[model samples]
Target: MSGIAKTPEPPYYAVIFASQRTEGDRGYGIMADKMVELAYQQEGFLGVESARDEGLGITVSYWESLEAIKNWKEHSAHKIAQDRGKAEWYAIFSLRVCKVERHSFFEM
Candidate 1:
C-alpha cells in the first residue's frame, strides 16, 4: 500500500509477515498482487501495509478478528500462494498474529 494502513480502534488484529526472498521473482510479483486484491475482498479485512528492502520484506495485514485472519490463512488461493512461497519465493519467513490493543497515527 502507498501509506500506512488505516485501521479501526483497539481490539482488532494484525497479521505480520516478515520474509527473506529467494533469488529471483519466480512469479512472486504476480502472486503478491493477486493476494492483496483477494485480501481486499475477504470478509473482515481492514487494511494492509507492505515494504521490502534488499531481500527482506514485511507485510502487515489488519483484520477485524482472529477468525478473519484464520480464514485468510485457509483461503484456497492464499494457501496455494503460501505453498509456492515456501517452495520458490521465500528463503525464510515468519508470521505473527497479534491483538492490537492501541495505536497512534500522524500525518502532515
Candidate 2:
C-alpha cells in the first residue's frame, strides 16, 4: 500500500485535510514533518498518509475516535502550526472529518 496508510481496522475516524499553499516554503515543510512526529505521540493516532504537488496537498490522519481527533486539533503545538498555516503557509485550506465505516485496498 505504498503511499496508503496501514491503519487500524474500521469504525475509525479520518481527518482529511486538503490545502493550497502560498508561494515560498515559509518553513512549512519543517512544520509539516514536525506535525506528523507530534501526531504519532498522541493517543489514538493510527496512521497518516499525505501527498502534495505544485502547492496542492492532501493529508489524511487516522484516529481511533472523534475525541482523539478533537484532542489533536486542540494540541498546543498543533495550534501554533495551524496559526502559522493560516498566516503564512496556506493560501486556503479545507478540512473534512469522516467516520470510516468501510474501506478497501488492492495490490498489483
Candidate 3:
C-alpha cells in the first residue's frame, strides 16, 4: 500500500511477514492482492501495511486479538496462499506474531 496503516490504540496484535521473493511473479501478485482483500473481510482485522523492494518484502497486519490472528491463519484460502508462498513465491521468509502493548505515530 501507500501510506502507513491507521491503527487503533495499543493492546492489539501484529503479524509481521518478511520474505525474500523468488524470480518472476508466478501469480504471486494476484494472490497477494486477493489475500489482502480477503483479510479486510475477516473478523478482527484492524489494518495492514506492506512494502517490497528488490527481493525483500515486509507486511505487518494488525489484528484485534491472538484468537483472531489464529483464525486468519487457519482460514482455508489463506492456507492455500501460505502453501503457495513456501512452494513458489518466496526464497526465504519469516513470520512473527507479537502483542502490541504500545505504539506511536507522527505526520507532517
* Candidate with the greatest TM-score versus the true structure: 1
Q: Count the backbone clashes (under 3 Å) in each candidate.
A: 0, 0, 0
TM-score of each: 0.97, 0.94, 0.96
Cα-lDDT of candidate 1:
0.94
TM-score of model 1 relative to the true fold?
A: 0.97
Which residue pairs collide in model 1, if any? none
**What's the true lDDT of residue 26 in model 3?**
91
Q: Write model 3 residue lDDT over 45-100, tens digit each, in one string.
A: 99999999997899999999999999999999999999999999999999999999
Output the TM-score of candidate 3.
0.96
Model 3: CA > 4 A from native: none
The residue-by-residue lDDT of candidate 2 on 1-108, one tens digit each, is 127788766889999999999999878889888999999999999999998889688999999999999999999999999999999998999999999999988888
Ten-residue stretch with the least lDDT total in model 2: 1-10
Candidate 1 segments whose C-alpha is farther than 4 A from its true place: none
TM-score: the better of candidates 1 and 3: 1
- Candidate 1's residue-wise lDDT over 1-108, tens digit each? 668898888889999999999898989899999999999999999999999999789999999998899899999999999999999999999999999999999999
Model 1 residue 78 lDDT score: 97
